[model samples]
Target: MFYEASDNDHKHGSFSEVRQDLVSGDWVVIATGRAKRPHDFLQEGKKAFRQPKRTCPFENLHENALLSLSLGAERGKNIKPWVKVVVNKFPAFQRGVCSIFHKTGPYQWTDGVGQHEVVITRDHERSLGQMADLEAELAVRAYQERYRAIKQDECVRYISIFHNHGRGSGATLSHPHSQIIGIPVIPSDIARSIRGSAVYYEEHKECVHCVMLKFEKNDKKRLIYENDHFLVFAPFASRLAFEIRIYPKNHVSHFEDASEAEIVSVANALRVSLGKIFKGLNNPDYNFFLHTSPIDKLNSFRHYHWHFEILPKTSIWAGFEIGTGIEISTITPENAAEFLRNIKV
Candidate 1:
């Protein structure tokens, strides 16, 4: 279950209170501490960083590709592939033993052992928001293929597939690219989400995300877009303004397990959703990432639901948010969803 404070829930003109996330159990403050209308978050006049093609590292064809996919007749050409996956030139984690914990003066530590690969789209200027449905599907397919390959590594405990859109969102290069990182340890945030799902399942005998999806689809207040196989919506307990999530209509535990049809549907949903944000909010910077079950114990997390979360850089964390470990969203999810729903993409 999720808890949110409606405008009427306020007493003595106080607008803010903490809302707990159903999956991660993290708290967020909604329209209380700081409040703004949805339009106020528009990123008009914000300049996006652009690197010249001559200087951009990803502008040329990539060699030593781990996986590559191409369209129709272009499959065998010497040109670049539609989508390509290559190891990161500078990886945060490297190929090494799954290090055991060692004591270091009362502290425990291990080597940062894992694999990191970059998934690059052929077009340097076209972001996912600007891509055609088929183009986006190819990118999603690349992620799935690379994920399947990386999960074969016994040392990998979790894999993260994420895209950073603009300078503010941490994209060093202007080229459109996503990253897949396989790590030996599960992220703390993901661990909490998994544990929460397990506890909820043990208590209710159903997936927490499935329950949320049912409610969101029926309520329709927080929903942005939906296709036959996927549903995109603004999360009720949004961590940031215009926070969006895309969930498969049917329960799925791992992203790698998604079928081709599901991938196509999700690709369309993602393209439309991101396009809406691009037009509605004046092309703001954003980051989107996949949240799925760990590779090591897939069956143990069947109660979990895999999904994609998109967080636009609408607000910066201040002292209160950083200190309390709770985010503050200036605009409510309902208003955010309503604004984006009417945007023509």
Candidate 2:
């Protein structure tokens, strides 16, 4: 059953209710018990963790590099690379026999036979938000290139490309880097998202994300930023405060399929979006990840529209959230979008 409140209750700012996600069909509570104004989130919670440059592993790239890009002049041998992709020093998954589930007394297991790599930008201190548009584009290009290479492995079924900004966001090192992990199995959350999208497509014959993007673009109330090829907006059912999503204007299932122009546009969109949060929210801890179709059966997920989701560390999940599997957001997306949209980043 739906948990909608009366219009008057919402108008009075006294409503605590649940909103269903159109794509994933998951519900998130807009709990007024812990309500917060958009600006109130700017108040510092925990200080961001920092690491010294001398001790940082990414400061000097001595590991066997998988892929490297140099934006500067290539004439000199000492010209440091702008962006580099290297295998994770301590990987959660490694090369092995293809994963196949084996029975184990009412339980099942498979080998963690996949690839994990780290994408490192040259600067230890410069984050994506602080990077120039071209610099950010090279990083995104690295993610796409590595994803293309990793997906070629027959054992890889899904690849996750994500960045963690602070200790709160699971970042152990202060160096600005993103991780790419290829897995033998599809994650439950991603599987649910794809299933929901497929269901919606079967019913409406259209991409669910494209439909949402169309409305968000037209509504403008939740639109934070938009370039020629991409749009950034707070989701109508944002699961957290200051949650932002960047979507391509056109429907594209695979991130690797994006054109060079589209890549540049997305990098600009990402930089601006993160810059706004960095300036407006006092550089809060956050995590951003790319959500795209799985590697196998690409044609089956043609209805999927790939995008990036940025979730700022706004509130902690307590019992109601963790136990119920429903996140509670203190601020509404409309207000979050309005606040971020006005920030001159």
Best by the lDDT measure: 2
Write the residue-wise lDDT of candidate 2 on 1-345 in tens digits.
545565322342557767789989989887776678877988477666778888998877799899998787545666554999999999999978896899999998999999999999988787999988988999999999999999888999999999999888889999999999999998998999999999999999998998999888887888999999999999977899999999999999989899899999999999999999999999999999999999866378898889999999877889988898899888888788999999987
Candidate 2 yields a Cα-based lDDT of 0.89
TM-score: model 1 vs. ground truth? 0.92
For candidate 2, list the clashing residue pairs, or say none: none
> Residues 11-51, candidate 1, lDDT per residue (tens digit)?
32466756779988898888654668778989988987688
Model 2 residue 47 CA deviation (Å) reads 3.2
Off by over 4 Å in 2: 1-14, 32-34, 43-46, 73-81
- 150, model 1: CA deviation in Å? 0.4
Candidate lDDT (C-alpha), each? 0.88, 0.89
Candidate with the greatest TM-score versus the true structure: 2
For candidate 2, the TM-score is 0.93
The parts of candidate 1 lying over 4 Å away from their true place are 1-14, 32-34, 73-81
